[model samples]
Target: MAATGQVFLLLGSNLGDRGQVLTSAREAIAEQAGSIGNQSAIYETEPWGITDQPVFLNQVLEITTSLLPEDLLRIILNIEHDLGRVRYERWGARVIDIDILYFGQTIMDSARLTLPHPRIQDRRFVLAPLTEIAPDFIHPLLQKTSSKLLQECPDTSAVSKIP
Candidate 1:
């Protein structure tokens, strides 16, 4: 039997009722993916990659599942589509954005999905929430804990924890 692995996912929304959008996405995830684990509090963060978009409310979730990386990506894309996500531009304003951060320390680079998320080290928005929930979880590539990475992260983008 294939052992289930703990996966980390990041969710963000900057369009419509951001809070509700995130909540609904989380609900969908719980229903489709395995049980949700430790979750970070939402953080309102300035847009990255593209600066002109609305600030995003971001959170990180820890989940345990047996799905392969590619299968997980398909499920995520379906959920995004179901929630009205439109790919207008890279890093553009979005109704909801779901990213696979880590899948059981699996490191992979493919045309469709990238594990340990390629830009994680450079994004404070990602680091802040990840650190909140899994501060000691080491990066598979950089081998540094999330809190340490957050401390050394150079991205000056504002990331404030929500109430």
Candidate 2:
């Protein structure tokens, strides 16, 4: 049997019925990726890199998966495509965006993916929901808990919990 790994995934949607899109993405993830072990409350956050887009509804999910990191990335990309994501520009608005935040302490940087997501500490939108669910989960490289990272995060763009 394949070994199951714990993974943190960030789901965001800024276009086309954002809440419904996130709900659909979560359902798709649970069906195709792994069982979701935990999830943070949805948050409304200002656009990070490119501020011109619509605000995003974001949440973090803790998942248990048997797929390897690369395979998981492939699955996530497919999920996004299925949900109407179109790659127009970096940090562009999308119908749904699912990002792999952490994959069981595994760290690798290739053309396709990065573990502990390179900008986790630099984006409040990512950190807010992450801190909600995994406050004590330490970054393998930064050696800080999610809460600590959020405390020190400089993104300051505004992240608020939503109903």
Candidate 3:
């Protein structure tokens, strides 16, 4: 049997029914990626990078999976594609966006993916939800807990939990 590794995924949506899209993403992840162990409350956050787009609904999920990092990336890419994602612009509005935040303690920088997400400490949107569910989950390379990262995050963009 393959070893199951703990993974964190960040989900965001700014197009179509954002809440529904997030719900569908969770369903797809559970079916195609792994069993979800924990989930943060949904948050409505100001757009990052390209700020002209609509605000996004974001959340973080902790899951257990046996697939390796590359394979996991492939699965999530397919999940996004299946849910109507287009790559016309970077940080542009989308029906759904899923990002791999961490895969156990694995760290890698490659053309395809980066473990512990290179920008976790810089984005309040990512940190808010992540801190909610795994406040103490340490960034493999940063050597800081999620809560600490959230406190130190420099992105001034607003991030608020959805009621």
Candidate 4:
């Protein structure tokens, strides 16, 4: 497969059975999004955006898919809904939060989606795991590698890998 269709995704859950939630989400993703390639070790992270919520178990994944970026977004939203994700507030605790971190080399800036996720440069929770699998992957917009982004990240929230 060409590199253009390769995509990176982040999954976070702070509600119930986080590990199981992630596992099932991965299964649904393979069915709707594409094949799951490299996946990072799950990380336990403090809340971001809204710090008054439960801490999250986060995981990052690399996928090779035929679905267009928007289509993939639709599928992820569906998965989140199926997993009982409720967006009562921004960055609030969720059953499952699936974010499209990167979509190959595509740089999109639309109302619905944005490629090379705008906040990745500062989120250690996202960068930590992403660097595990795609350390050298470049941010299409920032022109920086994942490792560099993680090193330079300013978000000080605690992050630790889980077995």
Please, what is the whole-model Cα lDDT of each candidate in the order they appear? 0.92, 0.92, 0.93, 0.91
lDDT of 2 at 5: 57
What lDDT does model 3 reach? 0.93
Name the top lDDT candidate. Answer: 3
Whose TM-score is higher: candidate 3's or candidate 4's?
A: 3
Mind sharing the TM-score for model 1?
0.97
Going through the candidates in the order shown, the clash numbers are 0, 0, 0, 0
Summarize candidate 2's per-residue lDDT along 58-156 as a digit string, tens digits.
999999999989999999999999988999999988898899999988889989988879999999999999888889999999999999999999888
Residue ranges of candidate 2 with Cα displaced over 4 Å? none
For model 2, the run of ten residues with the poorest summed lDDT: 1-10
Per-residue accuracy of model 4 over 1-163 as CA lDDT, tens digit each: 3434559999999999998999999999988888998999999999999899888999999998988888889999999999999889888888999999999988999899988788999899999999999999999888999999998999999999997
TM-score of each: 0.97, 0.97, 0.97, 0.96
lDDT, model 1, position 103: 89
State the weakest 10-residue window (summed lDDT) of model 3: 1-10
Ranking 2 against 4 by lDDT, winner: 2
